[model samples]
Target: MSKLTIKTLAKELGLSIATVSKALKDSHEISTETKKKVLAMAEQLNYVPNPYASSLRKQKSKTIAVILPEVADNFFSLAINGIQAVAVQKNYHVLIYLSHESFEIEKAVVNHCYSGRVDGVLISISSETTNAEHIQKLQSENIPVVFFDREFESLEAPKVITNDYESGYLSAKLLLEKGCKHPVFLSTSLSLSICSKRAAGFAAALSDTGLQTNNYQYVVDCTGTQEMIFDQVKDLLQKHKEIDGIVASVERLAMQIYMVSLSGHINIPKDLKVVAFSTLETAPILNPSLTTITQPAFEIGKSAAEVLFTMIEKKKHSIMADTTVILPSTLIERDSTAV
Candidate 1:
């Protein structure tokens, strides 16, 4: 059988195409009686409105674009779930894109938003995003955007962030209190704002403790790779054989640190202490419960969406504000960093 279209539904109900469209959306402009009739006929005719047709005329897809560095990580998976929950509640659609931590990919994704396929955007900058021109451009076009987690300092937009700096400080201080003299910081991005803030917090803590703020003390400009990180950890271990502690910036990197310790026969909290910034549900079940500065990831997503919806409303001339929101991160003390 041939598929049903808006015209078929409109003709059957003796209504205009616009009336049928408005009824389907349950727009206040469409009367309740009309809505009931249109809905009944639509169901009977199996009429499926072309989203693209509506998108073109209304300039609204009712969709939000979510751009992330990667979704393989549990934090983002949870964040997406949170964002999805709000989107569904607000009757908005979600289109996800992964930059894989590539700034160029992030820029391209932002550029694509000019197509008006989404009402607004939520982004976590990639590790390599040094400039915010592309993001600023989107803002200029009146496409209100919100940043969650990895945010840009240049853009004056609502940012939903964790307490990365304080969390880093807390994690590092915990390791030091546990008697780890040479606590190397493992991180993914030196260019990204979140990692930089975290590293700064750690360095501040180290300096305050009278630890040599010397060359070997602060290692920056590291490569991003499991193999590279493993080799770097090995080299750091070899240099400071007495190196007894580590503060990993990302969750996945912490796993690698754990693996390296195993291969080298280093015991946690005995020969070594480890801490990480993570939101993984599996953190507690690791070989040893991992001490971590856990981000309220779902809350971050929820807050980001809440802010984005507000911006979207502003764009639509609805009542709302274009304010920035930042969420706090929680530090969970686990056996891995216990003294």
Candidate 2:
């Protein structure tokens, strides 16, 4: 049998091609009864509307891009699931890109995405990204961009993020309450805004206890492979035997701390109290368990997707400007931070 088309439906229903087309699109010019008739006939004939043709006519790809630093992170994995849920409901496709923590790679990806490929973009920038020119260029081209999780604060764009600063304060407060006098703030990158905010909060909490700036340790610029991080953690622990508390800004660092402590025969919460911003499913099941400041990653993803779709469908790119949605992070107390 020949493929079904709009004309075929129009002919069978004794309607004009324009009328049938308008009816199929639920155009306001078409009466309700005519729309019902067109829908019924299309359903009866098993006619599927050609999305490509519709896209061409509407000047839309019906797609959105999700750019992330890494997908292996449990937080991002959950966020992707939430993004997919909304994308499927809106009949939109998602194109995922990873920057792998490289700023140059992230800029290149954004440049490539500006080629009218996707209707809108959602991004969680790389750790090394400090410049916002690439993202600003996309917004200037009328492509809506929403930031989630790791974001650039200087950019005048919509952002969905967890309360990193508050969570950091809470994590540090928990450790201090547990009798940790010398807590070290561990982070992979100092350039990341999220890391900075968390470190600030941790520092503020430590300051509340009348600790001097030098006494409240902030160990930024930690990166590289697992072995490198392990070695770094070992050296740091060995050098600062009095560093009774550790606040890891990232989950992998927390794992590294756990591994180093075990190898060194250091007891968790006894010798060193550890807390981290983590979304690991094994957090509760880890050796002695891990205390975590967990972000609402799924909700952040869903909200960012929703905002992007609204901009795409509404044709209003400026809707995302200066908009910020902050979600709360929960501190899950586990055996790792027990007194």
Candidate 3:
């Protein structure tokens, strides 16, 4: 009924406790033959070392923490897969945390990394995250961090991002050519760096084509559940008959627009055209097919882990990685934008 301990191993192997301890640590003071014999006997006795004790001795947790806004989205889900793959290769365990798009939750998650329970971190900021102080505080403690997909402004760290602004402009141009006169933007946070850049590019594209913001008539600000977004879409169409096209910043809201159009008897392409920024695999299979700006979610995640590992192993100094790297988004044209 007693648990395994170093003293027990020392007794079973007929060695002093200090020798057993040094052998387990593979210290230079312990002979290789002694280490092999001690380790073999310890394994036979079902010995399991205390992780906290090991961490304290080695100054390494052999673990990485991954924090994201939400894992419910397909993009984030795939990103996690990539992170796990790299963690497996490096023999590092991962602890995942979700912020659910709340800035307060993001602040708390970053603060926890100060405990040194994890050796490094990878984060994707929440929608409401606008400040960089929380992330900077972690870096100050020498905890290496890499940002994937989303990030905070003014943070001096390695980042992985997609070309949001160009993608947004391209999507808007596609909608414009599809004969949409009044296209409105639907977004979660126009303040978030990614969302704001995309919106600005979308606006620029509209202006270049001679259509002003007021010409769009209305931009329906949708929030909460899928059902709630659908209702908001319905209300927008009712109140603003001139809204004939859409630029959805998120895929979930874009799907809701399709649902609302079906229930309200509005025809896709004929009455309304849509373009969305999404990493959905089902884009080509939607009712009339769907057009989307797809980001390289998995690639970004893989690159982030690769970069973080370089920093973790290069202990004397952190990585002097290029501050920001932007991967281009691909716009897939489909029936959703047809006229």
Specify the highest-TM-score model's number.
3
Pairs with steric clashes in candidate 2: none
lDDT of 1 by residue, 166-269 (tens): 88788888888888778878768788788888998998899889887575765434456678878877677767776778888888788877888888887886
What TM-score goes with each of the models? 0.88, 0.85, 0.93
Judge candidate 1 against the unseen true structure and give its global Cα lDDT, from 0 to 1.
0.83
Off by over 4 Å in 1: 1-4, 8-41, 220-223, 316-322
- Residues 1-339 of candidate 3 have per-residue lDDT tens digits of 338889999999999999999998889999999999999998899898878777888889989999998887988988888888899999999989999989899899888877568999999988888788888888888889889888766677888889988887898888888888888878778667788788888888998998867644434566777888888889888888787789889889888889988898888878888888888889888887888888888888887888788889986325544557777889988888886
Mind giving the per-residue lDDT tens digits that candidate 2 earns over 1-339? 448888888899999999999988789999899999999999999988777677668778878999999988899999999999999999989999999999999998898787567899999999889899999999988889999998999998899998988988888889889998788889888788899889889888988887665853555556777899999999999988888999999988999999999899999989999998999999999998999999888999999999888888888777558779998999999999998
- Screening candidate 1 with a backbone cut-off below 3 angstroms (N, C-alpha, C), the clashing residue pairs are none
Candidate 1: lDDT of 272? 82
Q: Rate the local accuracy (lDDT) of all candidates.
A: 0.83, 0.89, 0.84
**Candidates sorted by TM-score, best first:** 3, 1, 2
Candidate 1, residue 143: how far the Cα is off, in Å:
0.8
lDDT score, candidate 2, position 231 = 94
RMSD for all candidates, in order, please: 3.1, 4.0, 2.2
Clashing residue pairs, backbone N/CA/C < 3 A, model 3:
none
